[model samples]
Target: MKPVENAEGIQASLTLSYIQATVLKAKATLTVGILNGAPINIGIVGQADVVSDGKEGSAGLVHTDLLMQYDIQNDQFDAFLKATVKVIIAEAKVPIWLYFGANTPIPIGETAAEQKTRQSQNSNFDYYLYVGCPDGNGASRLGDAFSKVKVTIWKMDAGIVSGSLYGEAYFCIGSILPKFPPLPDEINKFLGYSTQSSNENSVINMINQGGSASGFMFGALVHGNINVDLAVIRAYAKATVGFDVALLHVTNPGSCQVGTSFGMNNWYAVGQVFAYFAMGVDLHIDVGLFSGNVTLAKLQVGAAIKAGLPNPTWMNGRIKIVGEALGGMVHVNKSMKFEIGEVCVPEMDPLASIKLIAEVGPGTDNVSVFAKPYVIFNLPMDNKPFKFNVMDKEGHETTRTFRFKVDHYTVKSEDNGYVGQGTKQFSADGYTMTLWSDEAFREKMKYTITIHCKAEELINNNWQKPAGKSEEEESIAFTTGIAPDTISERHVVISYPINGQNYFLKNEFKGKKSMVVVDQRNDKYFKLENDSNPIKKLTIIEADGGQVINTNFSVNGNDILFDLPGSLKNSTTYRMYFSIESSKTQEIKTTTELVDLEKTAGTGTVSMADVDFSTVSINTSVNILGASGSGNAIQSPTTTSASERGIRNKAKQEQSHRDAIDRFRKGETPVMTVINEGIENGTVDPTKIQDGTTAQGKEVAVYQPATGRIIYQMILEPVNLTPSPIKWLPLEVS
Candidate 1:
């Protein structure tokens, strides 16, 4: 071995040699900087030998050193030295040490401190080896180096044995350094096999199964002729195996590849079995039939049935008249007359063509005849009531007023009895009778029966007694009196039984009969009876003078009768007197009567005697006395006959009487003097005097003739008196 210089360029010489196959130890010292500097030491191990350069005198004894250098900066030097030392010592070879006697070596033990100091010094110097051997192959020489040193071999077989090397010779060295044993034979079993062959076989099996192991069970079976590529097969196997591998890693179960290895031949079959298990479900399919046997065909059948029915002849359908036997026995010829209310069917299609038949019994002769079948139909009749009239062959001898009650007829079908109740009332004008029924009844055959009413029989059956009276009568009676002014042509003579006398009186008088005079002053009037002296006397003086004037007058012996006049004044006083002479007694009978009468009785009279003086009466003795300024005298002698004294007494005492009367007189004058000259002879007539007089523009003042009050009496009547032989006196006046 040689010492090298430090970084300061200092150099020193040192020698290292091995003497034999024993340990040769040497030490070299050097100072290094810093108190804690790393120390390094190196050892060289070799053998001592003889060497020649090919001359006889040149053969000499020499030593070869197996050097180890420690340079901390050079990993190659450190590794080579470490490895060489391990190999030499495993062989029990020798080694030489240098640099062992330093202060650093004493603190860390001589061998460990020397190695640290050399490592520090060699940081700048490189280490090298020198061999001195006599053989070209280095093994024997390497063996001698080991024999001289006392070190044993750390590991054997570190170098190549034989043949060309491949792969990891450095790792072999590392193995020997650690003395690790060889790998087991079980681990190396696949050491030299090819992986491509295994992958190719897997691809071939996948292809034989047609790329789908479950295809056969799915009915997609392929023959062995189907092929697949090895790469695809391998990829598929890897995906499957890797998936299971991942499962195992997470689950930490047994190896996943165990099933693959044991079941490789049956893999396709297993998949097929699983597929079949999935496919074992039930399935179904459906189909429908299309034969023409539905309801539409049945409808066509019904139409065909309708088509085969019989056809009608007239009016869109056949007409079969039907009639029903009513009250009378009816005789119907089988061929001529048909029954009403019978189900004739009217020759409709597909139905029977039979006509409704009807018959009458043996007693049905010479009467109204009708007949009907059991079933009646409104369909053939169109819901109209059936009507038929039976007549003789000549059509002249019809039944006497036989009326069919067609309103009571009904159309019935089959055994539905009656179609409905017949309409009770006939149509207006007594023509047709209609029956109402439901639509169901109209759809069937119907029979109708009509009742007949005989006019004569109805008249007899419904006869009634007559009623009695109509009204009542009434009578009335009324009465009224006749007016006094009515003429005598004919009068309404009122006859009433009074005081047991059946006195009849003519209300008026005519011709040879005396005029009926109503002497109202005497209340005596004449009434005519049925005898020759029908004129009777009535005394009704209770009437005014105006009511008595112009009244009809008549006379009878004693029974005086007259109607009271209506124009009598309401309040009046009247006096009446009658004078009559009795021939046998030679005496005058005189009497007076008074009446306080109202004016309503137009012809009332008071009677002095019982005789009616309605015809004639005497008013005698008019006396004239005095005037206001003249001494005119109209006086009569007291000794003369009461009837004849009018003129005699007037001449005898004329002047003296004038003087005597004028002394007692006042106002007004008398223009005339007259007397009843026939009063003494009993033959005075009142009608001889003027009926009425009017004053001729002269006012003769006199006292009131009725009231004795001074008044102007217009002396309208001029009177003259003749003197007589019985001592006449001068007329007195004033």
Candidate 2:
């Protein structure tokens, strides 16, 4: 391998086969070699360059014209490299060919000018090294003879056929970095390495320990972060290149996991903190022939993490179980029902972190109806489940009673809304509920949320059919009551005994009557067998004589004002009774009946139809104050006005009676007057007064129809009565 003067200031490819090379400061350390049947020490390969003065007449050459010849003084040889070769016959250590830069082929018997012309065009070569011989000589050639020796340069290309390119990715083991030192114990264990040289990872050890060993080959760089100017590249086949590329080597091996199952090898983030690569970038591969190249392929590694708890605000979530500490234990005291999938239960340790992992739909729409204040509730199938031990951070079980509260609530349905009057539609698909610890510092608290999914379709919908009974046990939702028609008249207003001692009365009619009210305001009801709000029972009694009427009457919404027949005597009271049939039951027995989907179209989600007449019937009375047949009408009390009926206040009237009695002794007894003037105003306090005293009186107001003016009111004579006790006998209870 000899080169003449033309090849100067040029870089060359140092082709080696079956070897490993490492990048070190923009240069390469070629390891492993076979030359002259002996391994060679590592040598440096520099980028093609030269040191020369550009002035002409220096060493009889200019920078552009040859640079130097073989002729040199002994002093000059000290500063400059020798361009001459000393080849002694039958001797070793004799200087042979002194070569530099790329090995330019000088054709056999070719003239210097012809070789120069070829070098200016395209002189092919593979590597350049000085071919040396020993200076110890058996015989030496004449200086002129050695100087006139011609050379034949055979190019190493045109003989190459096929080859491959390869790349290997590695990183620094735990304690030691990727360097020429003993590998770490962690890397040795991972690679099944035992002793120094008798291990499966010896190839890596050899490469690291023998860093300077020669004969190692390398590939051309396609893409890399190495600090070197990119080299000009060409395909080895030179056929047609750049189609669907079949890579023979890794392009970015640092970021890629190639042909390895390391991901499933139970690697934890323990010993190793960072990753580094021992990439064989720009490695040359061959199949006993030509060398092929590969780009810079990368390989990467990361842990497959087991996630934790989901966001607490999400409508649904799952509990992530890390280790199998609580093996096969099911502790589900709380539950969340999602709209999809099988009910999943997660078992975890008692003191695990309770963060939640939930996959929630983008935004949330809470559709929960609390039924009443303090009674928190939510819709079905709109929740996520998270599980954690109910133990304190110190490993003690905590039984703190916690309540779920509504952080957000609204009708999230896109399709439903209130229409007209009292009609609103529930147009949402479902609802949401976010349960949190009601305790202080609840944000720091963590509880295992167990998801309770309903297997029974009817149960999830709020109705549960009784075991033996055909009726279903239901849940009810009470709504805000509507406005009454008249101030004193409310059909849907009712009050009855709750705890047996005191009464729960409708506020509107609490003092107006004796536990009097019947809520018939809901003109609509569940499976109502009749017209709008039909009455199931009605009984009337003329209280003055205990005469009962036939069970027949018309019931309309809030018919609080009614009149008896005109034949009824003055001051006579009539008691009216109203009830539902159970043989006609009006009340909605169970709360669930209100929320059954089959019953309500999602709007009227509640029913209060159960009127339990088994305890006490609701009743009220009206008095026929004054009825005019056709004659003087016998001036009597009218239900129209309290002041006009002569039944002013029970206490005032009784005091007036006692005053009249005192005056009776002096012949000055006062008679009660039924005033006609106040009757037309209808300002009546209809409170009943049973005082056992009656004073006969008459009130007459003769009005002229043409002028519409009251003429006069005549107060007639008065008659007083006394109370008497009746004797009674008890019937036997048979």
Going through the candidates in order, what is the number of backbone clashes in each?
A: 110, 71
- Writing each residue's lDDT as its tens digit, candidate 2 over 1-734 gives 11111122322334321222121112222332222233222223322112223222222111111112221100010011223222321111112222222122123234668645553441221111212211111111212111111222211222222332221111111111122222233333323334522222222222222221112111111111222222422222211011010111111111112255211231211111111122223434565876665433322211111111111011222221111112224222222223222211211122111111111111111111111111112332332331222322232333322111122222221223311111112213223333221111111111111222221112333444322212111111112222211112223343221111111111212222222233333333222333334344434445454555434223343222222322322322444443333333433322332221121211222222222211111112212112221122122333434222223233332343343334333433322232443323322111211121224343222223333433221122232322322111111111
Assess candidate 2 and give its lDDT: 0.24
| Lowest summed lDDT window (length 10), candidate 2 | 238-247
lDDT, residue 247, model 2 = 10
lDDT of 1 at 387: 29
List the candidates' TM-scores in order.
0.11, 0.18
- Give the per-residue lDDT of model 1 (tens digit) for 1-734: 11221222222334333452223323233332111133223333322223323232221233233443432211123211111233322322222222111111111122556555564553222232212111111222123321112223122232222111111111111100111111112211212213222221222212221211111111111111111223212100000000000000011101112333422333312111000000011112233753221111100000000000011111111111112222123322111212222111211110111112111011111111111112122112122223222122222212222122221223433455653442343334443333322111221122333332211111244422212111111111111112122112122121121111111111211112211222121111222211222222233342234333223333342222344343333223222222222222332122222322222222222232222222101111322332332323333233443223322322433443444344336323332223435223322232332222224222232222332333222221243322431111122233
Worst 10 residues of 1 by lDDT: 238-247
C-alpha RMSD (angstroms) for model 2? 42.6
Return the number of clashes found in candidate 2.
71
